[model samples]
Target: MKFENLIMNVGYTDTGYSGIVQVVILRMTHMSMVNYSYLVVDHINNQAVIVDPAWDMRKVEQALENTETVLSGILLTHSHLDHIHLAKPLAEKYRCPIWMSNEEIAYSGYYAPRLEGINITPWSVGQIQIEPLFTPGHTPGSMCYLIGNSLFSGDTLFAEGCGLCFDVQGAYNMFESIEHLKKRITPDTLIFPGHSYGRAPGQKFSQVLKNNIYLQFKNKNDFTAYRLRKGQNKLNFFDFQ
Candidate 1:
């Protein structure tokens, strides 16, 4: 089933942004789970970048073909195996660079020696400006990309939940990152999450603030207490593969 209000048109206007950028949400199922990959295209130039491409290269290729957009880069939210599995092959096929957090390269122990790596920093393609926010917690190098008014929040903040914090330190970091996001991102900012774990594929920051219980915590201690009370499973970094 598709999420409600899923955009299908090319010239759709984002909530806060005045300019129209082409964004296609490509949903791919892998290992009995749904993963959402995004194609952000600069329609004027026909240049595009794929974010968190995992499983089903055929669908990815088909999306690119249907949009008539050329892939210029591959952007990774983190180095999770599920997210990066197709990065190398897609970059190789398109002759484009793979952009990721350098910290993830060391933390996850998954290296791409062949594909050219562009350290995740604020950059742009055509008219689209991408600001990479270092929101660690889900992983040491977990990042959220703010493109225009849309936030490509890897595994950091989800619909009503947040990423799993494997340790106490990660939990603290996650809390701090969430606080920071609230300060930086506007109310109308659109959140495009990595997984299809939410009620919808995407959400407005205003709605998330109003609806997300995790974000309702007044302090870090409360957030940590809630996480601890919930008994979140401690994850092994390498086991994600």
Candidate 2:
């Protein structure tokens, strides 16, 4: 059950906290948007959870069949449409619950029969422990899920840059979220961001801190000014990149 030269792909083993749980992550880039849809394969029980299910179901289904795993859950990092388009259909098909931040549900009025608003910090499904870190900035309820050492940052932290901010406060909030991550996660922790943006996904956190220009500002004001500065015109932004 392997596909080469497809991912932005990463695989590793962790002698997990509750004994060894082999972690196999399959990432497929969205056809139009570059959204990194991650399928975390729990080899122990032949169960899997897809982070921000979106785009083609054919690829997802094929991955599941190849890995010989059943979709056990859907984990969302934010309420953005591009990231969440496949949640309900996949949930209905798999009969698995969906997890998203409670704040996002309140703000976006997003609802589903099986969509559960996650309030408590860390919780478990079956044998996996998922901690939803409230990393709001790109949106009010945007969150990043902490599973083992990998951070599934949806529109919050990118590999070489961060997610776009909506306003002044949001820019500041994003700064705080990034700073908070610096304190919380270790250097070796791998970051699997929602989009590739500047660098590829699945880079070590230390590399992000070192290269991400957005992460260098110590003062929130400076960060906000630079982030929200008037050069966001698509025409202008594309020139810089």
List per-candidate RMSD values in Å: 4.0, 3.6
- Candidate 1 per-residue C-alpha lDDT over 40-157 given as tens digits, one digit per residue, 9 for 90 to 100: 8777788889889998899888878877989998889888777787899988888888888778877877666444444545777776678888898889888888887788897898
Assess each prediction's global lDDT (C-alpha) against the native: 0.77, 0.77
Candidate 2 on 130-160: residue-level lDDT in tens? 7788888999899998777778898899877
Model 1 clash count equals 0
TM-scores, all candidates, are: 0.87, 0.88
Model number with the top lDDT:
2
Off by over 4 Å in 2: 1-31, 233-241
Query: Runs in model 1 with CA error above 4 Å?
Result: 4-18, 114-120, 230-241
Worst 10 residues of 2 by lDDT: 1-10
